[model samples]
Target: MIDNNFKNEKAPRNLGLYIHIPFCRTKCLYCDFCSFVSRDEQQREAYVGALLREIEARGTKDYSVDTVYFGGGTPSLLSAEQIGRILGEIKESFNVSPDAEITLECNPMTVSDGDKYFKELRALGVNRLSLGVQSAVDGELKLIGRRHSFEDAKATFLAARGAGFENISVDLMLGIPSQTLDSLRASANQVIKLAADHISIYSLQLEEGTPLYRMRERYSLADDDTAADMYELVVKMMKDAGYRHYEISNFARGGRESKHNCKYWRLDEYLGLGLAAHSDFGGKRLENTRDMERYLGGEWLEAASDISNSEREFEFLMLGFRTADGISKSEFLARFGVGFDEKYGEKMEKFKKMGYFCEKGDALALTESGFEVSNAILTEILDFDY
Candidate 1:
């Protein structure tokens, strides 16, 4: 039965692809990304072969993919042959545009192997490299269980440049147990020195099972006040370095925003392939099993759900609030076939009255303070069933 509920809504699809590589050299303390700590080449080769098979088995990709991301266990850990094979699979499976922004997640230690890694990655058509250089200080790196040193990260950047990578993004974290303002700045400064095109400045999140979370039982981390200070410091430093804070945790130089992640922020559809991967396509949300065993045998899809109209609306408001440029008013109206002012008039009016939302032409954008308590503000706008 077709529901009339969202008959007024606009549905847009500019598709993207996410390929997951669930293998890692070591797991970090505050990390929870799906990756296994193993050097089993046999397992890796087998996984690559299976992934190729999966790619081959996929339904026809009718849309031209503008962005394709190879996220990790440590994609850099893969042999050149392995990386090439996967890219070949991608080429064979879908119509990836020639100028597509193909991004690969790499580790500092991985590229220390030199031209072999970078040359192969470039040859395979990856244009962007997101390097995980969590911290520059050795102490902070140790505390966070990161394998690369400040020096190693520099070496990795040098290697990438030597290998002819022009578009590179560096990942750094804030609010670690031993992290300080000076330490954090040093990390950022070193990364900026590399002249990376983009940077992902993430806060240290203590998940339930991670080592950092367990450390909470023994040592005190930076307090909320200090963490906030660290985040603000990062914002300032990155901005001063000529990077735009396009998204909360991301910054890019010039036009170097991450196309892959922007797809997520824009609420566009994507299909993820690998253990513990998630996919949102055709109004359906699906997640693959986190189990490697299940992935090997083809019993991998763990869950699927068609999102409710209410849920989609909630997502729209929540995600729109995350970007520097808040949701487009005309686009919002077009999507819902009604004035955004009509749907969330109370909240919009309330916020504008309170000076939280500023009228920006046809869009309603969050003021600095509005962005501060964005969750509370968005909650007021959404008609959540829960």
Candidate 2:
């Protein structure tokens, strides 16, 4: 049941919409996301139908959507019409902002007919494109089970440009099989030459049960120290190229940061739809079922939990520290009714002495080196026994 307070509130809250398209042409060796390669058109159509039904069932006028993100096993794998229908349903269900930042994640291999595909998406209101390029070296790409070559990625990017996309982001990986400093530099330089609006570089994590993890011994991966060096090098390169390091793993040109993703780090409200999607709204955390059969049959929710005040406080600090701006002292007090210094002053002083933490104006943030070992630092600092 919808909350009466939410429906009767004078001002509607800003919300973000995340639609998961769990379909892929081919799964990457290192991938563990909920996705599969399905050639059955009927099954895909059925999934889309289920999504439309869910949107209607959950639709509410109490929230205004400012961002819409289409993420998945290559969301571009869906037909343009299917993508349009999903967006259309969202608009019908919610008061989507006129200038909402709508983003879609695409794989180069899936958008081979890039010109037509991207043009259709552009016409359907997708203003941002996130291409999964991973690496620019063909050998590195092949080793990671990516089907497209670097050239193919470049062409896809250009095609999106030609189709009138001004905001495009590319994904890059740091530590991969046989990745060296020189090769990593080359890849970074190549991506920079593309002049993309945004870039997200992440270290490769070999998840358990993935092909790369199962055959981990077959490939040569970088050591922790070498991977750290590569990270520092990329940071310098991005700084020299005039990209702002807004978040731990993201860089953007002036005024081109990902608005949708920022909502997550800021702990803003958002609604996630589709198979295995997760949402945090109205002081509640919810996740959709990972089972495709259940999702297709309209079983949307897998689990739901009410967030405690302490958990919210810890999450605010944890997620806020992931960004370069860090957390605001006044804002923390306003939200939790307690001064941050009163709670974490001792820990902050210790970290400051170690040169790992600093206070800029009214906000407290971690240094670049601090971000490298943030997991340990945050674990120690936010270990409240409440």
Off by over 4 Å in 2: 1-12, 384-386
Which tens-of-lDDT digit does each residue in 1-386 have in candidate 1?
33313222343235688888988888887778888887898999888887777767763467677788889788887887887888788778887778989888888786557776798788888899998888888898888888878899888888887888999999888887778889898888988888889999877888998877877877667897788788888888988999988877889997999989987776777888777778887678989888888788876689999887666666766887777777887767656566677778865777788888777787667776676666677766774433
Candidate 2 local Cα displacement, residue 195, angstroms: 0.5
Report lDDT (Cα) of residue 151, candidate 1. 92
Off by over 4 Å in 1: 1-13, 353-355, 383-386
C-alpha RMSD by candidate, in order: 2.8, 3.2
- Residue pairs with backbone overlap in model 1: 10-335, 23-73
Q: What's the TM-score of each model vs. the native?
A: 0.92, 0.95
* Candidate 2 residue pairs that clash: none
Which candidate achieves the best lDDT against the true structure?
Answer: 2
| Candidate 1 TM-score to native | 0.92
